[model samples]
Target: MSNWVEGQVKEIKWWTDSLFSLILNADVEPFTAGQFTKLALQVDDKRIARAYSYVNAPSDPNLEFYLINVAEGLLSPQLAKLKAGDTLMIERHATGFFTVDELPASEQLLLLSTGTAIGPYLSMLVQGDVWQKYQHVHLVHGVRCNADLSYQDKIKQLQAVYPQLIYTPVVSRESANLGLNGRVTEVIKNNRLFDLMPHCVTPSNTQFMICGNPQMVKDTTALLLDRGFTRHRRREPGNITVEQYW
Candidate 1:
């Protein structure tokens, strides 16, 4: 067998206009819900590696990941061309710090994501840990329009049963009766991020997870810090956990 075996592409699903999910039959031990894995593509005699966050539950035998097709990415160009039978290299090890396992227990889990950065959050939710820990799980996703609101059916179904899980879609421009009509930072500045929790994200019993654009990550991190939320790190532990993928 090849040391780096080819993972079989099993399933493909589109969440939104720009997001797509692919399932691969990766041969490896189970990874944590919020870890990332690298994908390799053959170029001449060398292999190119690109890291991607997991978007599936670890209990599942096969590996799955969500991706946003960026027109300029060299690897994404070939990754998008894959089909059910097609093959792509899957890394044996999965790693990342952006998981619910790192942060301390809290009453509220504020998952603020943008674009394709919502991958890990979705994985966390699908794994059932989101509702397991927090009394209230609030997901504030920022996108361009309703068409960008991926996982609508799945998110809504979760909200229907678990009223504790709330989803607020923030659209910057296109808003045809979708959700909030502005950028997520503007919403946070207006105290919208705390509307889900009665007491807000205080150091007492709230935690934050932010992903997406660099500006958004920076602005939201500063805003949370001003509100008494500290960054969660391996050394200096705080209430906020962030993974900047911009």
Candidate 2:
């Protein structure tokens, strides 16, 4: 009864110099839409692993993981070199509490993410459950530059299918002609972010799911708290939910 299973690399999609997505074929157990699983590789007779959220829907035949090749990292560098047909180790069961089912009832659902942290939200979006649960769903992805905005076609496809799905891309380094040209927290603080949304954000109507780098998550949580939002818990249901990537 081993916990690890073999996953064959089906494809590798390179979006940028540091960003990539691994499409793998593995017989993983049924996972919730927003859950994450660990991938491992043997390095110097030792096993190196890292947790990565699934980008594909749970029902999809292929298991997909979005990742960034961290410079001077241990596991990611090896993972980045993997090719189609190569085998890797994947945990048999996915785990995480970041699914939509964990949220409290709200009219609006805001999914804010940065970099590769957008993987889980993409999972939830494509799974088709969020659209039915919330009247309006906002997906805000904050990136350093326009080139870091990966999965545009997939997001556009979901937008077409679900008209209520609002996507706001925040490019901080340079001007984003189509999107906001500031950090997500800055835009929200200055009231520029909500300008693109269909309705105003209130603690009563909005449930925030913020996932990204630790700094972005921390700052975003603090900003929301300042606006009267509280951290969500099963015993004490509140507005903001968060998951930090690295």
lDDT of 1 by residue, 1-246 (tens): 444656889877776545788888978656888888888888667787788888777887767777887788777767777889888898777888788878787788889999888878888888887676789888888988778877778788777878888788898887636658789888888876576565656787888899988999999899888888799887887888888774
Per-model CA lDDT versus the true structure = 0.80, 0.92
Query: How far in Å is the alpha carbon of 64 misplaced in model 1?
Result: 2.1
Ten residues in a row with the worst lDDT in model 1?
192-201
18-117 in candidate 2: lDDT tens per residue?
9999999998899999999999999999999999999999999899999999889999989999999999999999998999999988899989999999
Model 2 TM-score?
A: 0.98
TM-score per prediction, in order, is 0.91, 0.98
